[model samples]
Target: MSPVVIPARIKKILIIKPSAFGDIIHSLPFLNAVKSTFPNARIDWVVAHGLHTFLEGHPMIDKLWVIKKDQWKKIGYLKSTLNEIFGLVKGLGKEKYDIAFDLSGILRSGLITLASKAYMKIGFEESDEGSPFFYTHKIKGGMDNHAIDRYLKLAGFIGCDTSSVNYPFAPFDNHSDICNILPPNYVVISPSAGKPANQWPAEKYGELASMLPLPSVVISSGADAAIAERVVKFSQGKALSIAGKTTLKGLMPIIKGARFFITNDTGPMHLAAALEVPVVAVFGPANPVRTGPYGSIHRVIQKKLPCSPCYAWQPCSHWRCMNELTVREVFDVVKEMTET
Candidate 1:
């Protein structure tokens, strides 16, 4: 039997990606591509409340719907949370979305997809597991594709003709003074990772910061201030730690202006890669082959420990994978990236 042809009549689309900063960053190009293909379409995003800051003033997003997990998890908060969820569903229904894509492919997003009244609901196949079973159109063959490319392919199923994934970001206004302070040819050294297992030694990054000829800025999520402080201290006053100073939206302008970015395989690494900034990413625990920066102009440093890419639960005791990477090796890559 011939597959059912989804009506190309999709104008109002809801993109459901509700967690992880890096995954959302990876999805931005696909979102941008959707707008490029359907300029008239109203593109609404449903993301985690924590990441709402990143999309606050994005020109292409027609609406930003957020799900606050923390508030919803409290014992007495069920009624209010459900009401909020219902309100989101009603608001989404009023927009009359013709299509909703569950890009995050998780249970929470599955609930959101089920709640919405869009005619077409799409998500990943079941074998990916942990995925909610609410999609009307489930696309196979995503595991082999790069994460960004997978989103493009999903867009294709919706008639988006996503031939190219391009990300055009709006510069945040508040950081102009911060940008001025950075050297013209500086590299951003992002030393902290969300999980301890994925992080290289902060002392090593501080050591590397001191060796670099160009002035440097150290970045970390506000949650990792201790590590950020260590990098700043290790740089011996050569580096500025902007870890807790900038919100997600405010950091883009700083990243866009940097000459190069050195990071763990974290969200900003994906953002820098998406922005076309040169990147030197260090990888361990997670599979770099699956999630490393895609396209040219990016370099990755990884040691081939036999137990590397172990995908350990965070804060593993036996983390020689990332620990084996020395400051000197990462510095060599940073020098190469800056020179070329």
Candidate 2:
């Protein structure tokens, strides 16, 4: 059955997108689209705790309800979780929202939409049948389309021009005045991805670090300092690894000031692209079209093996596509992008 559209009189909205840092960042444009259409509408987002830091005080969002899943998933804490869930539901019910959007389109998002109990629930038509049952309207979304455009289409269906993708964090400067501390022309090298196969070789990153025209700093997950150590060792004094040194919030300022960024397809890669910094993003098993950095000053490297873009989350024993790429190829692309 086709989704039932609600009236334009709808003024309150609840949007749910829970995890996967890159996807959450990508969903920002959809939120902006809805805001553009209904400027006076009070928009609320349901997200995990740390993720809210990025969305702190967003003009498009009137409130952010942080959902702690781990706490809810604990065995002995079921009652506590229920209480928290009840409170969240009460808050949403109090808002008297006319429309709720399950942009995440996952089981978790579906549950959140149900909890909101809004009159009109919107989500992806391609989502699990059980999930869509909770939604009043469903927009088409999948691999053939860019994720950003797919989300925007949902807003468009509800009268949002959401024609443009906006990065709320790009214009908002929450950094210290120590912008002078950074080198005049520096390149940000993020040698990290959620999965190992998507990551370029540490030595290769080091080799590229040695070749780039400007000073370089390596970014990594604080929990995994060994990766940064390998990158530094391979770079032979050409790289400075800042793993375990900066919090997610602290790193944005560094990325914002960078002249350019080179990274494996990762969250920071998207962040850099959104910040309008030129990026040379390396891709392997993942489809760059659906999830690559979205910006004009960007280059995506994919070898296109018969098994290319497998989207495998686990470490691949033989990552042929990534292995085939040489440091020189990436350096050349960056040089070309920066020079012209």
Candidate 3:
């Protein structure tokens, strides 16, 4: 495939992958390639407000444009939201980015691409919500590939080297306050998924945790604390709750401390994968090929059914895909991955 045309001098580069914890984590390798390829260029990123904390103080990225996405969606905040968006557009327009890659293939991201007036706006050809139309160059980011590889294809398209994939995470302190409360060594359980369809039952997680040799620390965002708490409740004192206690940055050390990670297709699962923490990723409707724990050291446990990879937004009435996936099945894999 012919590479996107390069400007004589590539100066300012923009990367648009605004939100979703896992998606942003997956983009780190792409960021690595871009920085390595254009070491001198000033690179900037557009990230969602709450999630921006994860990318905060990233040395690889020159600046962060925090988008108040949740507030933007509310009718009550329309005026402020518009003003914020307009200011963002106006500010980005002044940068005259030599190249911009919309890693996110949604209409909002597409609009950001248009607003930037990038010399070359790159996005996936199969991007949903007609996001492809805004791209000056559209690359076919194959659906079957892992999210990392799919993102790398775009890197390769823009002349960035994809041979070496590395996650450049922002620095986090292992000795922070949250870490003080954690057990000397424990397994991390991210007992929540953004979608109902992807989640393995919380009680199952507790069962798995109870059987594990190491103590388990259940974690989640403030909103998802109930799910984490449910897992802890089922662990019968074998697991403890650290949910809502740590920020995105603070959680890194906690995960790093884990001997292994057990999660139900959540963002932190990707984080653990990136951190080289052996992960037993439970899957249901979501395709592990596209978004499971990425590295080879990890194990993916799923109840194989023809309807799997359906990528359902909500669990079907029966929801056998997840319901039938027993705790023993997942625990055995975890033991195989960790004990062996």
Best by the lDDT measure: 3
lDDT of 2 by residue, 1-340 (tens): 3324546567889888876677777888888877766778888889887777777767688888998876887979899889888898788777777889887776767877987878888888888647887787777876577778778778787777765789665235567444455567788889878887788888898888878778787887787678877888888677787786765667778888898888998888888887788888899998988888886678898887999889988657888889898888888888888779
Better of 2 and 3 by TM-score: 3
* Model 1 lDDT per residue over 1-340, tens place: 1234555455788999876888888888888877877788788889888788888888899788988877877879889998987798787778777888888776777877777777888887842445546887887735757788888877776667677778756456756556776777777888887677778888888888899887788888778888989988888788888787777777788888888888887888888888789988888887777689877899988888787777765847767777677888988887777677
Candidate models: Cα lDDT each: 0.79, 0.80, 0.90
Q: Which stretches of candidate 1 lie over 4 Å from their true place?
A: 1-8, 126-132
Ranking by lDDT: 3, 2, 1
Q: Per-residue CA lDDT of candidate 3, range 149-246, in tens?
A: 99999889878889987999887786678777778989999988899999888998988888999999999988989998999888989999988888
lDDT at 315, model 1: 49
Q: Supply the global lDDT for candidate 2.
A: 0.80
Query: Model 3 residue 62 lDDT?
Result: 91
